[model samples]
Target: MSAAADFAQDRDTLHFRGDLSLARLGSLPDQLDRFDGRVSRVDLSAVSRIDTVGAWVVHRFAARHNAQVEGLDEDSQMLFDHVVGAEQPVAQAPARPNGLIRFVAEVGAAAVQAGRTMYGLLGFLGATTIAFLNVIRHPSRFRFNATVQRFEVVGVSALGIVGLMSFLIGMVIAQQGAVQLAQFGAEVFTINLVGRLTFREMGVLMTAIMIAGRSGSAFAAQLGTMKLTEEIDAMRTIGVSPVEALVLPRVLAAVLMMPLLAFYSCMIALIGGGVLVWLDQGIPPATYIQRIREVVPITDLYIPLIKAPVFGAIIAVAGCFQGMLVESDAEQVGNRTTAAVVQAIFMVIVIDAFFAVFFTWVGWV
Candidate 1:
């Protein structure tokens, strides 16, 4: 039968009695943890037998109290010495900071990350500018065939969906404007509302959003895949400038086609609004068209034509920047593609707002 381990303190010495083996440890380890008193010495004379585990516990308790360990047999003394030599403190997890501190730290980290992202994007823009300059200097470096293919991909292929969305959006706007204007006996003004809104803002804005999601994501995914396959690396090795070969063609196509797409979107939206006007207000399509011509100024057309190419450039640049940043795996390609769409859309909206304010200030409102 094994004797249970026990401990007591007296004469400023902690005495451990009974068999101090691991099986008999019981609550002694815990008691040692809770033990409090002046301990000048550890008396294990009464300890019947001790295992390595028991020797470790005794040695630790003695060290914690800075007490001298005494009354050990030769074997126990050797075991205690080994335990002492082997002792090493374990690493503990850091304590958590309070909420306010953590919040500040997180915000600071996010701000720093955003600054870095802006810096990288600006750097990429500068590099693209230099590449474009080089292409201008050597017109033969301009890849006309690649630009043609990208035109089909980014512009022509997107026409159906973009046109359909514009039509539906225009119908909704006309119907809603008609409903509100009917209350004022000004239902005819729905023509002006739909015409001016679509031509000046919604046409290009919605097209930009669509392009960011469709073509921007495609750019990121395509470039990301090329990077993953090391094809971009191979091209670089062969003296091919990826910016000119890949990025420029996409960027040029987007810039050239955006105006055309926006114009198409505006016309389709006008037709959609004309249809709604005829059905809802019993106004004839010709009359609705005439009213739109009278109410919507030439300045309305200037806005989209001015903004479309910039929006296109922003979308392409954002997509290519995110794509170039992608690394490691297919998962990162998907992530960068998502980031590209979000960044492109966000920038488009922000830039559009600034343009709106500027146009208003310039009396184009």
Candidate 2:
């Protein structure tokens, strides 16, 4: 049978003997842990067949008591040195900060992030402007086919849904207006309300929101995927300007399509309102059309026409900007796509409000 490991203490020194392998040194570990007496040195001259586990135990004991180890063979000494070198500090949890302090810190971080995002967006806008100027100088660089394809995607394909939604919204507005006006015996004024509201605000605003959700998200996802697959990098290597090749076409399509789409939406909505007015109040379609022309101002039509292209540009730019910034994994593509839709819609609404105030100030109200 193999001899068991043993240790004896003489004053400030410890003398160990026999095999110092893992299983053989079982009780020696427990003894070292239980003993609390001073130990200045450990003598291992008689030790035989020492292994890594045994060396670890000896090293821990010497370290705990500030003791020196001696009489080890070259192999055993190397093993002990490896164990000592492999030590790591234990981690401790940090204390929580005060609630108010945490809240202020969060607000400060949010403000800083917003400032950085604004800065990046402005830089992207400048780059797009430069690309536009370059394309203007060299008209041959424009991608006619790509822009046409985007027109189909961003405008023609969206008509059915946009028309349906505007039709429903117009019906709702006329019905509600009739209900309120009936009490005052002013049900005929519902036509004026529908015409004015849809032409000036709802037509372009609703179309902008729809396009943002549809085309803006699509732009971000497409470009983000290209970025992930290094297609954008390939374009750069081939001396192709990504902004001119991809972004300009999409933005131009949106800008050209939005006014047409908004006008179509307004006309469809007016038709729906006319249908509602005839069914609910027994008014003739002829009278409804004449009344709309008489009550709705020309300025109302111009408002949506003016706003549509701006809203479209914002949507396209926001989407392409988020997409070009994408990096890392497939998950980032999805996140950037969502960010694009949200950013476009928010900017559209804010601009819409500003337009409202400006127009009101200029006597367009």
Q: Give the top-scoring candidate (TM-score).
A: 2
* lDDT digits (tens) for residues 174-200 of candidate 1: 999999999999998999999999998
lDDT of 2 by residue, 28-92 (tens): 89999998988999999889778888888888899999999999989888888888898888887
Q: What total of clashing residue pairs does each candidate reach?
A: 0, 0
Segments in model 1 whose C-alpha atoms lie over 4 Å from true places: 2-22, 26-104
Candidate 1 weakest lDDT stretch, 10 residues: 1-10
Clashing residue pairs, candidate 2? none
RMSD of 2: 3.7
lDDT of each: 0.93, 0.93
Candidate 1 clashing pairs?
A: none
In Å, residue 284's CA in model 1 sits off its true spot by 1.2
lDDT of 2: 0.93
